[model samples]
Target: MYDSGKIIAGLIVFVLLVTFPFISNMGKASAKPKPSIDTPVINEMAVKKCVEPKEFMRAEHMQLLNNWRDSVVRNGDRIYVNTAGQSYNMSLQNTCMNCHSNKKKFCDECHNYMAVNPYCWSCHIQPKEQPNEQPKENML
Candidate 1:
């Protein structure tokens, strides 16, 4: 019992030190980012829809992509039919990126926010993004 007070003080200090990060960052989390889908192809579409429903894609896109990779590589299958019975090509670049041209806005925003480093680009090539050119007004 001679060192009981000192032991308690050291334990409190250690607990505070361990919990400093949680205490310091309380209620300071950033808002979830909303990815932009303002590509010309999507703009031209009458109905703005993806290969699957928005919620389905948001939750199961990784699994869907993995299945697509396996289907294409292993079985040489290139067609994907959605739940709505609509057929789509399984090419990520030609199909997905064809509409989602703004990678920084569409893909990077969510990926960065989620702190994920997806290895899709290792085997697949990332589509080249065209620079967003603001329309210059003609000076009279």
Candidate 2:
């Protein structure tokens, strides 16, 4: 009972400090970015479809890309058969970039929103300014 007043004041200060951030940021969060798929290749497709389904691609694209890299580089497998039984060339540059040429709009949008720094550009050349003369489909 000796330091009851001091203890109460300290507890109140600690609670305020802990809750300050949440209170300040209430209703101020930016909306998540929706990646665009408006490139020429995508637009020209009579039936616009990705290698995998949209739901699967959204959640597991990174894992799939990693698997592709391992398969292509390590195991020397260059083909990917999706869940739908369609075959595709497993490539980030030729296959993916061919369709998703608008890298800033398509790739960077969601990546930046998620605060991730993918090392895709460290070794591979960025295809922003490079023109693909004839954008060919990777799927069979």
Score candidate 1 by lDDT: 0.86
> Which predicted model would earn the best TM-score?
1
- Write candidate 2's Cα lDDT for 103-126 as tens digits: 877887887777687888777777
lDDT of 2 at 67: 99
The reply for model 2, stretches above 4 Å from the true place, is 1-13, 23-29, 129-140
TM-score per prediction, in order, is: 0.79, 0.77
Task: Please count the clashing residue pairs in each candidate, in the order shown.
Answer: 0, 0
Model 1 TM-score relative to the real fold: 0.79
The residue ranges of model 1 lying beyond 4 angstroms of the native Cα positions read 1-13, 23-29, 130-140
lDDT of 1 by residue, 1-140 (tens): 67999999999999999999999989997688889999999999999999999999999988999999999999999999999999999988898889998877898789878778788877776666754643132111
